[model samples]
Target: MSIVRNIGAEYQPGKGTAFTVWAPKATQVELSLKSNPQTRVPLQREAFGYWTGLSEEAVPGTRYMYHLDGERDRPDPASRFQPEGVHGPSAVVDHTSFGWTDATWQGLPLDQLIIYELHVGTFSAAGTFEGVIEHLPELQDLGITAIEIMPIAQFPGSRNWGYDGVFPFAAQNSYGGPEGLKKLVNACHGHGISVVLDVVYNHMGPEGNYLNEYGHYFTHRYNTPWGDALNFDDAHCDHVRNFFIQNTLTWLRDFHIDALRLDAVHAIYDTGAKHFLQELREHVGQLEEQEGRPFLLIAESDQSDVRLINPINKGGYGLHAQWFDDYHHVIHTLVTGEMEGYFEDYGKPDQLQKALEHTFVYNGLYSEHRKKTLGTDATANPARQFVVCAQNHDQVGNRMLGERLTELVPFEMLKTVAGMILLSPYVPMLFMGEEYGEQNPFLYFVSHTDTDLVEAVRKGRKEEFAYFAAKGEAPDPQSEETFERSKLRRSYTSDPQQQKLREFYKALIQLRKTHPALAHPDKPHLRVKLDSEKLVLHLTHTGQEPHLYCLFNISNQPQKTQLHAAAGPWKPLLHSADTAWGGPGADIPEMLQQRATVSLPPASVLILELFA
Candidate 1:
């Protein structure tokens, strides 16, 4: 064994690179440069698994593999990027080689962003970074300000949700790997749209995970439903924390990404004094200061803890935004009447009014899902709060039969839900294929190298539905067919149903952007009136430049009632009941023509902007 392990190796601007690994237990580790016949160069190690070597003579295009224990060569555990597939060898890449034209590019602000979340593999037919660019014009035209992609980190297979990523820095080779991502970022910035990468720091994918050999990166002390928890608080945690921290910065700086959406932060187990999130926030803030623009860190957490956005001076992690699951639940329940499962706590028209009013339903209120009161005092900062159709991803895929909301709710009901979702005071997000109400379902599927793990996933899915076992029908989650069916039906534009849904979404988003009451995030002054026939909610922005939004979440029966809120100059911009355009068939007529004393139809959702 050699005496030195160069953790920080010397840099070569464009030439082939050198790498080192730290494997204390291993007797020998060799660096195999994949050139000509793929020759193996021996490595030297230090005391604590710090293996070092130099490939000064290797070319930039050479594909190299790390051979540990003097046996078969594996990919680098800390590979900066993956060009080939995950199973292939790690190629030498120069971080500064890619020319970026974003010198004047600052970044996107939190509240200003209308984010569209997409999974690269299914986003386009090509399923590569280049393929996604072809669809960028569609996103740009849709009035989206940023694109939030599911993780692209190298996993075991050609496709995944990216939460299972083990190589934190390496981009998935199947999705244009590293170089392709840089190009994507450049293209986005050129179009003045930011890219927010959805990253998973909670747990690594079970397959192609070689972190166990590199260092103490995972722990068995704390168990997660998904195998082992990441090592953030345990032994040798300082380095482990640094590992992830560095990874975040690399994504921002190296990949030219504007923001990171931390996936399932509720699952990130940390107990440090300067908590991991706080540290990450501090670093990101500093980077923003250096870059001189808005760089964001949004967290996907069901725990509606206000401290996540509290400034460091106030002892909070200072995340820019958070995904509000309550918002989605409220909308889902109202539109679909899905009273089973978690939807049991939602579906009431009042819940819709409350979510828009406060941004959280369970704000210390009793939750049937948790079987307890949830959240603390968050009424203090409702604007900084983010609410959305955020229960995307798993919500669409986890269904026993893998179905989307389009499968349940009528198109106009979907449009009404869209009005409420987009017009609310909090930030809004749309899931991939949701804009047009695509019929494909995103299912829970994985290609694990371990056969036993495959069977285990199958059994887990079958038993998960004892609540619906009485139906005597269960989805076959194990079959490759299940995975195939879950892909989005891309023929949305040509399909009549999808075309109408797309038009509805387009109008709703446009209304949100143009209308003053719906554009900003502020808890509006609210008046609720419910009679035997209908429920009407009148909303007014509280502060300066106040505006109004009125909703009639009525039933299928026509009714007209007087509202209690102060009469203001309100014009009906939209009504869900007028369903000549592919929705729940209800026609509330133009009796609402610029007048206070108007009519309402059953099961209608209406929006009228007001000026007081």
Candidate 2:
């Protein structure tokens, strides 16, 4: 494998631009510029199958492509901007052009994060990065410190969930492309909000993928659910790995992204002496040390192994955090009483208690859903290393009708569930429109240009949801109606129930930020007790500042639970069933003595702050 100082199109003011690409299989390569098919500049072959050349006429904003073997024209493999579309030519973008004002900005710590995940295409009426910028103030007002955006890489067409991205470095064309993304990041920093992008490095989208044509980017030896696995451990894999490492650095350095949430890292099959994830983590660490800025990497792994966040010296990958799906599953199953598919093993009340005290309930235990022993112990890791959410893109978009928790459970239960998520020991995340209880479903939608691929996707979606006997044919993935129906309705908050839900979420987040016991991210300091028969859960946090106690009754029956206070009085902080929150039930008493038995309303949560 050959290592180059820099790849892609690097531009200078009067010096024009330099172009470099790796195409070992091709005998020759030429650079085509500015919509002229006849204009071609031959590049000299360098060591290790690399083609390099400098064009005095090519400058920033100049559209170009690489002609392989003087035959077909293809976009740059590391293109920074694909304004026309994925199948169109690449445009040279000036990285230094955007005037960023966040010079002294330092990112927030992992433990202090309150993430709100969103898909740009469906987040607002504009369906662009500019549209998302308008809502950052509201999110910050809601006590969210970080905004986790779904994948934005260039895909086949206009609309997608973004897992089908083919261009690893290019911004999505329909979402205002590169300049728009830079503006969004700049605006976020102005409001003291950090941007965490969800990135997919597991596999490329099948449609309009040209990586294999330029070099051996994909390996046939390994397979993933999407397609062939990326060649991370094969011959000439050094540059392949460098391609991804450089892409990540481009986002952090050029676009000023605070963090990256790696998507489905368990699907990245690599068996080399030096693992790819470790190498990527070291690269990011070096950047952080060099620039003296915070850059976090959160992996989305299903293996349930704590090694993903463990220290590198301790034989681990050293990533900052991982997505905790088990926490969501436990809450979803226990709150909704659904026992099907992967949720078959999680409806028991004890499972939720385990998730509250520890990160995962399936750690080093038998999984009835998988029919095998799954996961390793996670008790040794801190609660900040896990990002827990009650609803996300996968948990809602993959369902038969794309129904949310608001549709499945009662309005009172929604507030109770929100309390459970926001007040937990782990970092909390909320799905788009979840805070306001928006009624529109987040269905899976795509806009692929290929007719054959579109039909195949529709057929596969129907077969995948066939297990749900009550549901019939799913909405067509290619239809415009599917994408339109998924857009978030900002006007829904006018309703009384939705306004109450929004206020309830805001209060919970505020409590999580202010309360001394709830602010900490230590699972060891937390205690959980679950009464399965009465469906009541009691959680306590023993701390020096102000002790905390929370009781939740998931069932629809009012029950009384004893509060075990230490020395002084306990003040009621929040009650989900109170009349102010659109509930018929009355509020809990203002004060409670030690060992007082309090009656909790049906399907409600009571949070108390113990005072000395």
Candidate 3:
């Protein structure tokens, strides 16, 4: 943690700003204030490639850059705000200047998190952090405890999915800078909504990348899908690791971020005694102990490893939770009946049941997709350790057409799928506009300044989906229209059909909060039974206070099953086939008798409260 000391520009109001940079390779480093070559402030070169200097001329709002070896100038790698974009000089931002009102806002527990993931560029009409503030009340009303915002780091251009961000510490200039982010976080805390930021630590973007000139930031020993992995275990990697650790602290301490969703943890290749992930977790734990507030770390890991969410005492990385893709794959294939690519292992009723009973369907089992046995036992993990979603940015945007669940499946089936996710024991996350059934496609859009890189991205998009016969031509990634097309239409919720879907989602979320069986995170209490031939799923809950019986007809045809229960009658809590949810009508009785035959309509979900 001491490695972060004297790094980046620290500005004071009455005093001046102190500039420090880690240019270990450079013989000499100079500070250029206001991007003016005339005012070159000489920095005292210290040991370990660090240079420090104090300048009265450099103040808050002043744009500056580091002149390495008295030659080429590069933006500060630890810049707090990049007001002029990623390629331009970094601005000196005083984080203490923001009058935040969330001093007493202790974050919610991981189990209570109903995460709503939204992109700052596409969530609101203004497409800024301030624009997202206006919609806080709606999310608060929707039972969302945490708002997991997509990456807002400084990217090459205005429009991007944010994966191409190079400046990890700075906020995107087009979507408002550091001050804008603070304002949004303060506003969210005021609305009782905790903020979770998505951060990419695996690799930096190709364009506007200047870390290589400073130190050995990347390692060629291992490569990621995006680029070369960060050098976490290599030589002189102490400061390199501290660079990201300080970034996390800046969000948690300065910006009052409640949690971090680590982007693609599987890509962060590190083979060391103490992994970078574990170090990050320990640092966060120390902060939590000092602040007496719960700060969580969530990982987006595709490896299906339980060690990510396991406790440190249990020999694991100790992250709070991870994104569970198996839940999505099973539900997607079961509802839509699409068995392509990774969806091949899923489509069966037994698979869905397995996913329900256990967190991972392929826990130590052979995966047909990977052509090898994938995952380990995660049955011991609590449900809250997993964040499940039917539709997300990767699932929807990675497609050739970028079609959402609304565009892929029928309206009734969409409600059924929503019921499954919200009622599940695991934490639920709703992608932007998923609650209202917004029809806009979340296309992958980028605005790179480099012509060759832009053309390469366009070419790669087509080549990646060339084998899929069902998918048509993909939208041009270089086009501005593609970015605009992904923006959410808030007015869509006003439509009758869309409003009905939103109400259904709201009801399920509310029931999840109220019902013990739905809210409980214990897996042993939940029992899942599947009829593969009829595509019927019966989930019985007996562990908690409120016993529940959930039945779903995943097929497109009606199915009947005989109910065998102990004694008394069961009350109807929610029926997906009810007229209120834009369904045909109720198929099950209001109060069921023992050994009574119950019928379930096509693409319907029924949740009953046991009163025995």
Q: What TM-score would every model get versus the actual structure?
A: 0.89, 0.98, 0.97
True lDDT of residue 170, candidate 1: 86
Please tell me which predicted candidate would have the highest TM-score against the true structure: 2
Encode model 1's per-residue lDDT on 260-356: one tens digit a residue.
9998898999876777898888877777787677678988887778778877788778887888887788667655657887788777777666666
The number of the candidate with the highest lDDT is: 2
Between candidates 1 and 3, which one is better according to TM-score? 3
Q: Which wins on lDDT, candidate 1 or candidate 2? A: 2
Instruction: Assess each prediction's global lDDT (C-alpha) against the native.
Output: 0.71, 0.87, 0.86
User: Where does the lowest 10-residue lDDT sum fall in candidate 1?
Assistant: 1-10
Give a tens-digit lDDT track for model 2, residues 1-612.
234346788887789889988888889999999656678999999877888999888887889999998779999998988888888899888997889899998999998899999999999899999999988888988988999999999998998999999888899989998899999999998998889999999989988799889998988888778777899988888888888988898899889999999999998887997788888888888889988897999999888998889999999989999999998888888778888889997888788888877677888889988989889888879999999999999999999789988899988888888888887888999999999888899999999999999999999998998877577788888989999999998765578878878888998988888888876757888878888888888888774368888888888788888875555488888889887887776657789887888898888998888866
Better of 1 and 2 by TM-score: 2
The model with the greater TM-score, 2 or 3, is 2
Error (Å) of candidate 1 at residue 23 is 3.9
lDDT of 3 by residue, 417-437 (tens): 887888788899999999888
